[model samples]
Target: MSVNVIILNGVSSSGKTTLAKAIQKYSHEIWLHVAMDSFIAMLPDGREFDREWFPMVEVSREGEVLPQMTNGPSGEALLLEMRRLVRGLSETGFNVIVDEVAEADTIADYRGRLGNGCLVVKVDAPLSELERRERERGDRLIGLAREQSERVHNGISYDLEVDTHAQTPDALARLILERIAA
Candidate 1:
């Protein structure tokens, strides 16, 4: 089946965003990149502790700082609209690339939102590599990768699975292209 949307599902810091950009850069067809973070960024004033915004990170008894951001109302509304936007874009015949941290609920939601014309790709890396990347980036919550690494793919299935720990985004994108073309 032909698809207009590609969803890259993975934990934070797994390079889904980089892969999406690489796919856009190299693809013969132009695609619009829609990232879940783009909606998160729309939260007013970037509030973290509002409990209506991102609600801040949680700490475990073992001193693990986990940023398990379950969106409060405002964030939820934004995400809902983002999914709708993706659906609308694909319906309009635009090729779309989605960079997402797919938890169980959103995976199911995306299936309904993106319709039949979508490809879900599992983007992943080892937890160690993910943590390293997160620390190297220094812009994300310290434990987001650790927190999400275990849960992102729990209930989701994908058309392709790619590991990014030892590869560049461009190479990975080429692999995805070749596999899909097959």
Candidate 2:
């Protein structure tokens, strides 16, 4: 059987990783959870925080602080390499679940590469709830959810939409499995 890839796109603390893990745990199919965060975490020391390499800025609006990442050439190259890695895994018949916060251009880039067997899912949560989750997680950079709230889903539609605030991760994973089976 040909492998299927489910791409979960959302902002920080939107539960994409949680849902991806839930899907892998509960689903009968052996699914590889491939997260862009993992690829980003693999970046050489200091590269992720270096402005010359990654080019991030902090902006404050209405007392809310947020970070803006401008992925310069180096960052873009890494993203492309990560996308290709996901593609290669799927092409080799590994069912993959990708967790990413992708804007329109990045989504388009993946669409062109992954082609027919890929399903794009929009993982959503309200900004308020996302902010709360980010705070609770403690590991995420503060304001990341707010920074991405408006841009992550811009100009994109999905094969499935799941709101983390509305359902449990297992419930959402089950729903995705049903959709895939259909």
Candidate 3:
């Protein structure tokens, strides 16, 4: 079977993971859910991900262009690895559902490195609504929101935009399926 890589990106509380789960549930193919954040969190040695480290390594003098690393791992090491995993999975004929921030730099990296045969899905929610959800979910949601806000403000683009502000996960999944069909 030809691999279909589904990428989910968006602001915090955007329901990317939720959408990924829905896709896995509805898709007839053997879909694999790969989450960069979850993989990084699973890293051994009990090392917590340093959120502020990117702006440090990736910041530039012009402010016009925040620098991005081309070296191993770059500022977004986990994401880079996730992209690599996607490439490998595609090569192996596995349908992959990737959930990440999908920031501009990473998207460029993916385009340059991963080639074609993939779908980019962007999930979005109002900042205020996201913030409220963040406050409600506490640490996990708050951290996710912080990363998502930074990514979106930094200017990220996608092939499909899914707004999950009021829709159920199943509804969002149906929308994504229809988009993919189109």
Candidate 2 per-residue lDDT, tens place, 2-121, comes to 339999999989999999999998899899988988877887876876654467788777786778766777777888888998889988888999999899888888888888678899
Steric collisions counted per model: 0, 0, 0
Residue 8's lDDT within candidate 1 is 93
Off by over 4 Å in 2: 1-3, 60-65
lDDT of 3 by residue, 45-70 (tens): 33443442232234433353332322
Query: For model 1, how does the per-residue alpha-carbon lDDT over 52-169 read when each residue is reduced to its tens digit?
Result: 7667657463576576767778777777888999989988889888888878788789888766678889999988999999999988888888888867789777788889987889
* Candidate 3 wrongly placed segments (more than 4 Å): 1-3, 50-75, 141-147, 150-154
Model 1 segments more than 4 A misplaced: 59-65
Error of 3 at 167 (Å): 2.0
Poorest stretch of ten by lDDT in candidate 1: 56-65
Q: Between candidates 1 and 2, name the one with more favorable lDDT.
A: 2
Indicate whether candidate 2 or candidate 3 has the larger TM-score.
2
Q: How many backbone collisions does model 2 have?
A: 0
The positional error of residue 55 in candidate 2, measured at the CA in angstroms, is 3.0
* C-alpha lDDT of candidate 2 relative to the true structure: 0.86
Candidate 2 displacement at residue 154 in angstroms = 0.7
TM-scores, one per candidate: 0.91, 0.92, 0.76
lDDT for model 1 comes to 0.83
TM-score for predicted model 2 compared with the true structure: 0.92
